[model samples]
Target: MAQMARSPRQLGTLIQNARLNRDLTQQALASMVGTGQKTVSRIEAGHPGTKLDTLFGILAALDLDLQLGPRNKGEPDLTEIF
Candidate 1:
């Protein structure tokens, strides 16, 4: 299912769900992502301090990706490179 995450907490929930769905524990995921279990725990708890690189790494590890689209025609996808 495609879940819409409009907040950091919502995104955290989605990531946690994906991890669980893959039968992965926070420790396992942390090991795979070269981070600590506490970091994973904090991430799942929606800690606002989580870094973008860390988030992206975890997402990639979970086989998930992010897409940023514009809400209007004049908006551009900033995620793309020139």
Candidate 2:
């Protein structure tokens, strides 16, 4: 299933779900990405300071691909509603 993440929190949730589905602990995933468990935790918590390289590394480690596309205008985004 394709998940749309328009916010850091949503993106973190997606990453967390992927990691859980793979049965990988934060530490294990961090080890795969050459980062610390705290880094994984922060990423999962949607910390805005996270680097793009680190985010990409985590996505790669979890076999997840980041896709970019034009935002759909038909459906209102959460930010717009709030």
Candidate 3:
């Protein structure tokens, strides 16, 4: 997928969509990711201050990965040059 800037809520929406597309319920996903249904619901609701590890777990469950990149033109390219 093309990288686009998105807020946490938007990210959550994307994750929710992916989960639905995979035909997984919130509870099922939570079980797969070793979290609670309420935690998944909170994330889908875009609750602020969610732990980074929790987000990573959700992404992993959705078969997705997070990639950090420069947010501005002048930002340094931290990734190793190929």
Candidate 4:
């Protein structure tokens, strides 16, 4: 399923959910992406300073794709999915 993330927080929530769905811990994901668990935690918490490479690495590890499109007006909150 595709999700619309209007902000870093929303994007982080989606990443967190995907990680949980795969039954992978933050540390496990960090290791897979050659980073520290703290970094993973930060990313999951929507740290605005997250680098593009790191984000892409995490997405790849989670087998996720990032697509860009015209933003929808008044889109529902991403958290509503849970």
On TM-score, the candidate that comes out on top is 2
Q: At residue 60, what lDDT does model 4 achieve?
A: 99
CA lDDT, candidate 4, residue 70: 76
Q: Write the per-residue lDDT of candidate 2 for residues 1-82, one digit (tens) a residue.
A: 7788877878999999999999999999999999999999998988889989999999999998999989887978776854
Q: Order candidates by lDDT, high to low.
A: 2, 4, 1, 3
TM-score of 2: 0.90
How many steric overlaps are in each model, in order?
Answer: 0, 0, 0, 0
Each prediction's TM-score against the native? 0.80, 0.90, 0.78, 0.87
What residue runs in model 1 are displaced by over 4 Å at the alpha carbon? Answer: 71-82
Error of 2 at 82 (Å): 6.6
Q: Rate the local accuracy (lDDT) of all candidates.
A: 0.85, 0.91, 0.80, 0.90
- Pull out the clashing pairs in model 4: none
Q: Compose the digit string of candidate 4's lDDT tens values, residues 1-82.
A: 7987777878999999999999999999999999999999988888899989999999999999999997566766556544
Worst 10 residues of 3 by lDDT: 73-82
Between prediction 2 and prediction 4, which has the larger TM-score? 2
Q: Give the distance in Å from residue 52's predicted Cα in candidate 4 to where it truly belongs.
A: 0.6
lDDT of 2 at 2: 77
Instruction: Write one digit per residue (lDDT tens) for candidate 3, span 8-77.
Output: 5667788888899999999999999898999888888777888889889998988988888657766444
